[model samples]
Target: MQFAQFDVAAFLNAHWQKRPLLIRNPWKAWANPLEPDELAGLACEEGVESRLITSGGKQGGGKLALERGPFAEERFGTLGKEPWTLLVQAVDHYVPDVAALIEPFRFVPDWRIDDVMVSYANDGGGVGPHFDQYDVFLIQGLGRRRWRVGPVCDAQTPLIPHEDLRLIEDFEATGDWVLEPGDILYVPPGFAHDGVAVGDDCMTYSVGFRAPSRAELAEAWTAHQVDAMAEDDRYGDPDLSLQAHPGEITAEALDRLHGMVLASLADRDAFARWFGHYNSLSKYAETDWRPEEQMEAEEVAAMLGEGHGLHRNPAHRFAFIAAGEGVLFFVDGVCRECRGEAAQLARDLCAGNEWSGSPSEEALALLAALINQGSLGFEEED
Candidate 1:
């Protein structure tokens, strides 16, 4: 599933986050990974995030309609002839082949990589003209789609009034293309674009990247720091001196107060550790990924001894950072300090490769814990 012909470094320099680029059939062999029926089936399952959008049909009565799912299995058959699209979020988490699509895009940082959202649109169907706050690579999976790219948009841009959809009020395309299977369109943040199905059975896999807003970072990071603060760690002025106006706060006092706040927040080491856990959090926090049966350390070691490798769970995120003589390994919202063979194992696991390291007792214990917690699993032999 690797790209047949493409320059990763060139794409990043020229087009990534700068503008749009359309790539035609870049894969070694382009094959539709999931069928249209299979996608519809996923939309009907409970706990799966999905949506059905309709326009100019009985469902919406000429206006755009948005319905959240897990929809009834029979609902697909009831939709009358109308432009409509079905969107399922994080499809790669549930589908293995779909998860494989992310491998080629690993040129991007793993932390910036978000889940793949797959959309199935009928003829003339689309979600309408809109812009996303994050970068996305839209891979045409089945059939053809007409995609139009427009100028960059921002918060100042006006939108057509709709309850759920944030469609642009007026769209003027600067670029247009009809993409077939295996074609990819890279859309950067703030760029307005629209895609409409040219015919039936049109599916597109959108591989999105995470772009944390400043406000969001400030809020989350501050909250995390606050939780660790002691109650007695309040502002103090032991060096206070007599002032002309007792009520007036002096510039020196302001500097001290501001410095206190800034100094606390400026702990890069603490922030890095916090972000490792924050970024590695499971997308579906409520969905438990723990395995049914916990494996013993001896059993896990034996399996590794027998040449079985471990694979990371697609639903969970893994990352690490150097800390002193070891690495702080973060996975599924939990962090552990790994040293020696355990450190090597953490690096290997985060690489998303089959774990094939020489197993030590410490490493085996870590592996058993990960397997039990559902962050890693035994790779199946072919």
Candidate 2:
């Protein structure tokens, strides 16, 4: 699913995060890759995050109604036919077809990607008018959905308080449109918007991005620095002048105490490496994605000799940053040092869906290690 007709530069310049933009049928021919039944089946699986939002006279008219799931098999059947939606998070981690939908959008840096969330709805159904703190591309996958965009919202904006959801209290639509299959709506962070199914069997594939807030970065990185500190790394002003007034702490002591924390914060190199490892952590990090039989160095060498290429797990996140004569490559939050051919191989693996090249023995060693960890897989090409 290549975006042959879309203009990447123009979109970035005019609208990347500036405002909302509507791209009508960007793909050559938009064939929806997942079925409603298939999506429903995914919702019923345990450990998969999912939710059902319902509204109408029978249940309740959009005031506050939501159900978290791994739902029962019969749950979908009981939702009636109107005003209900099922949303499944991180669908790309489980469905290859859904994962492929992310390929065209890789123009957005791979590291910044969060995950793909797919939602299905009956007529007149919506989660409600609300604004997200992260940017998202709402891609219409199955049927028509009437979408309305409102003014930009901020932290001071009022929200309808509910135990389960944060919905906009008063929404004033400034733009409205109906999206058919293949159409896409790009909304930036803090932009209020709502989408409702105009007809039955409406499906939307949302490719969301991560945006770390300032407070979050401060807290997380501070914690990382704190954990790295030595037990004896406490503030000490050894030049203790005889205190004229012991009850009042000296100004010099306060400055020395503050400098202790500032010293750690000033280490930009350490922060960079820590952030790279932190952000590369995958959503499926806790779950084992490794192979049952680990590959040995000899096996990997033989496979590469046989012209088999390496394929990364769709659930795995791979990235690299340039270091001295080599690059520090990351897989599922862990870093590996690779130089020369191995460094290039790391770049290649992260750039494309498949990796193939005449390998160095050193590169093969790293590949063998990755294969054993289940971060990458080797298979024969048909």
Output the number of the lDDT-best candidate: 1
Runs of candidate 2 with Cα error greater than 4 angstroms are 56-59, 242-245, 379-382
Whole-model alpha-carbon lDDT for candidate 2? 0.88
Model 1 clash pairs are none
On residues 4-99, what C-alpha lDDT tens digit does candidate 1 reach at each position?
A: 999999999999999999999999998888888999999999889999998867654667889999999899998867899999999988898899
Candidate 1 C-alpha error for residue 137, in Å = 0.4
TM-score of 1: 0.96
Which segments of model 1 are wrong by more than 4 Å? 58-61, 380-382
Query: What are the lDDT figures for the candidates, one per model?
Result: 0.92, 0.88
What is the per-residue lDDT of model 2 for residues 1-382, given as tens digits with 9 covering 90 to 100? 7675999999999998899999999898789989999999999998889999987555555464899999999988787765888999999988877888889988889988999999999899899999999889999999999999999999888999889988999999998999999999999999999999998989999999988889988999999998888999877768887989889878898888888879988888787777789888888667788889987888888887788878787788889888899888998888998889999999899898778676888988988888888788876456
